[model samples]
Target: MANPKELDPAESPQAFYGAELRRLRLAKGLSQEALGALVFCSGAYIGQMESATRQPQKDLSERLDVALGTDGHFTRLYPMVTRSRFADYFTAVRELQEMARTIYEYDPVLVPGLLQTAEYARAVFRAFDPLRLAVETDELVSMRMERAHILHSPTRPRYWVVLDEAVIRRVTGNARVMHGQLAHLAQLVRSNRIVLQVLPFSAGGHPLMQGSLTLMTFVDAPPVAYGEGPYRGQLIDDPAYVENCRWAYDLVRSAALSHEASLALIEAAAEDYASEQD
Candidate 1:
């Protein structure tokens, strides 16, 4: 185990994409602002997409290829970079996933990001980096689905997650995929390896009204709580802060449906979606 090689900004894949985007922009004599205006996105979004800080969606991907007149490079570049899950911002997500012995997750909208179905996860990923094609979305989805293997490892962590009822009801993708997703959601619930609870909208004015959070406790260090929004994320390591978040989670659990009851809710939703499919 020697020191790892330092990565140069010009040598990395991100740099490659960024440099190429910049070259195309300069070659066309278009400013970032001008390119952003044409794409119907912000200048910063254009910058981020070019820097490979975010993936471009299908429409944007095609637009870039045509806008830059690069036969097909940007179109091909979109998926080539979009397939990675944590990407450049949340490398810690993967690091934390590997470190924790017990993972406590609270998802107020959809399923805990970790427990998302392929389609659901893809939708989430697509929502982040909107210019990827279906192939890229599928690739990213596959990468995320494979991450669930941690649940079955020889020394699996104790994973407890709470979901908002709307998560099960908010169908993602087509009716068939939604049906399959609900089934997968129910199957995971029945595995007995996890304790999952669902908080309904009817349980109005709940304690944690904002969004999703996760408290991951490592065997060797103090517990840490991580929170995320659609575009931002934070990792909390301080004892007082983590404790406060844990307390809030404990109260949320009290207000949510019991584990068995939650499973029933998920099962019923799965059947509902399944019935529609038949």
Candidate 2:
């Protein structure tokens, strides 16, 4: 087998955590598989953590600490490793989205962040936290815009999204903002950059009616499911749970309008917004 790559702890907090994990495992004379068994995770997952390709999760860190007899060392370091501009729970989702080979998303109330325009995102942020300062909102908008850059890349993930009709009807910033956002979606659809379907109100209740869901598949890693609500998000990597999420997404897709019809509806909504702006 090829020699394992050396980790540079200076690279980032995650890298540092990986390095520390490796050090403890080696000190205990344990192989990745051996350590993984102790922690109740797969050997490959341990390797991914050591390579800084996967962020360490809180519960896993606690388990690792107990398994390695680290006296809460890993648990204490978990927060630092995950700290980012994005919410703690969303940091991993953001990282995985960039590395995914295919992405399937379902949102009930708002446009998915990957497809949101600057104005639309800004308005949503402001509305969610009316007391937030302008500078804070600006910072968030910039980060979100930067995240969307992956969609423009040549190797961008195959993106498919199902949006509830409410997403299009609700005026987010203003009439003009809604018009621009819908127009942008139309352009993306027209350019074949993404596959989008609208889950109309007429479809009635669905499997994913409770909140938003994102399912991402990777070339080298296992698939993951992310579910988000107002302020909380959960990322699931367990094979069984991820499979269930995939099934739910498939159901949502089946209930949504066809691509052509969805585009027509989007265009009609854009026209309605345009008229309101006038």
Candidate 3:
């Protein structure tokens, strides 16, 4: 058998947690596959956690406690690991986005990060971390922009977005920035690169009113759903849960304007922002 790669726990909390997990699993003489089976995730997921490429979810942590007989060692460390990672829940989502054949999203507030311009993204990062210094904000903004590269790839997922009217009307930075952001969205829509829909406020009290949700479908693997809030995120892969979220997303889509109408609404909002900038 090959020797395991060295793990430097001093790198980060995730590294410490992951190295400890690997040590415990190895001491128990369990293969990654066997361990993942006990924890109800994939061997690949276990590998990612052990390599510190992915932060273990709370559910996974509890299962690991029971499986490895760690008596809550992993569970107790879950929150600490999350605090040390940026976009904690999104790490897996980003991986899935690359492999997904279709990506569907519904956002009730700000624009989706996949479509955000640099200026808009910076403004969002600043708003999200009001106490963060410029260097920290720049790092996050760069990461967000880097993730957008999936859309620019030659073979990309078919992206469909249902944005609440508020997303278009709300200003992220200055009026000029908002105008540029909306204009960018409009160009993407016109180019057939993405499908855009606006869920009008007049529709009122529709499904997915509570928070934003992303449903991703792959050619081979099972579908997944990701729900996001201001400060927390959850990745749901259970078939039943993902199905219910998919159903709710369909309802939101039904309540949204048709593609052409939605494009017109977006463009109109951009013009409104441009006039204000004047």
Candidate 4:
């Protein structure tokens, strides 16, 4: 068997937690499998935690404390490791995005974060909280741009997105910003970086009209779904619920324009924005 990969404790809070967990487990003379058995999870899960590839949950941390006789070490460190630049509710979803092998998204009102240009992201953030300071807005934009880096990774997930017509029709920031944003989307589509479908206004009504949904599938774990609204988000891992989200996504896809048609529509929208800019 191959030796386990080495972890750098200095990488991040999660890495430190993972390294510490490994140290403690070894000190207790327990293999990952043995420790996982005691915690009621799979050895692969323990290995993932040790490698900082998986985020540790509160309940799992508590269980690790009990199994490793660490007296709440993991439980106490959990919050620090989970702290994120994203919203509290979105922390887990961000972590899962890094591990997903495929990602499917449906947006009804705006461009998805992963596909947003810096100016577009700033505009959205400013609109969401007009009272926010410029520095704070900059920080949020930086974090968002950092998240977009995953798409450029060699092992980036296969991304498929369905966008409602309003996403492109609604003017964000100004005509210039909208033109740039739409142009960026067109470039991405033309380069085959992502599969995009537009759900036109003529589609009438759809099952996912209420909110946005993201479904992610992993290589070694079960699929999960994320639903988001104005200021709230929920991460769902229950097989039944995830399956239902998948079904809704399929229905939405059926109601959306074909990839080629969608690209043409996006290009036309961009041209309209450009005309307005002139």
Q: What stretches of model 2 exceed 4 Å from their correct place?
A: 1-20, 24-47, 51-87
Residues 58-117, candidate 2, lDDT per residue (tens digit)? 888999999999999999988888673133457668877877899999999999998999
TM-scores, all candidates, are 0.66, 0.77, 0.73, 0.76
The CA lDDT at 91 in model 2 is 64
Query: Highest TM-score: which candidate?
Result: 2
- For each of the candidates, the C-alpha root-mean-square deviation to the true structure, in angstroms, is 14.9, 5.7, 5.1, 5.6
CA-RMSD of model 2: 5.7
Which of candidates 1 and 2 reaches a greater TM-score? Answer: 2
> In candidate 2, how many clashes are counted?
0
Instruction: Mark the regions of model 3 whose C-alpha exceeds 4 Å error after superposition.
Output: 1-87
Model 4 CA deviation exceeding 4 Å by range: 1-29, 33-44, 47-87
Which residue pairs in model 1 clash with each other? 56-131, 56-132, 57-130, 57-131, 57-132, 58-131
> What does the lDDT come to for candidate 2?
0.87
* Model 4: lDDT of residue 238: 58
lDDT for each residue of candidate 1 in 1-278, tens digit (9 for 90 to 100):
11112334454455466677777787999887788777676665566545544445667768888777889887786665544423443555655675579998887676665677777787777767888898888887887877788887877788998888877777666566667776776777677667788888788886578878888886544577778886767665556778999999998888899888888888888778878877
In candidate 4, the residue pairs with backbone N, CA or C atoms under 3 Å apart (3 or more residues apart, or in different chains) clash, namely none
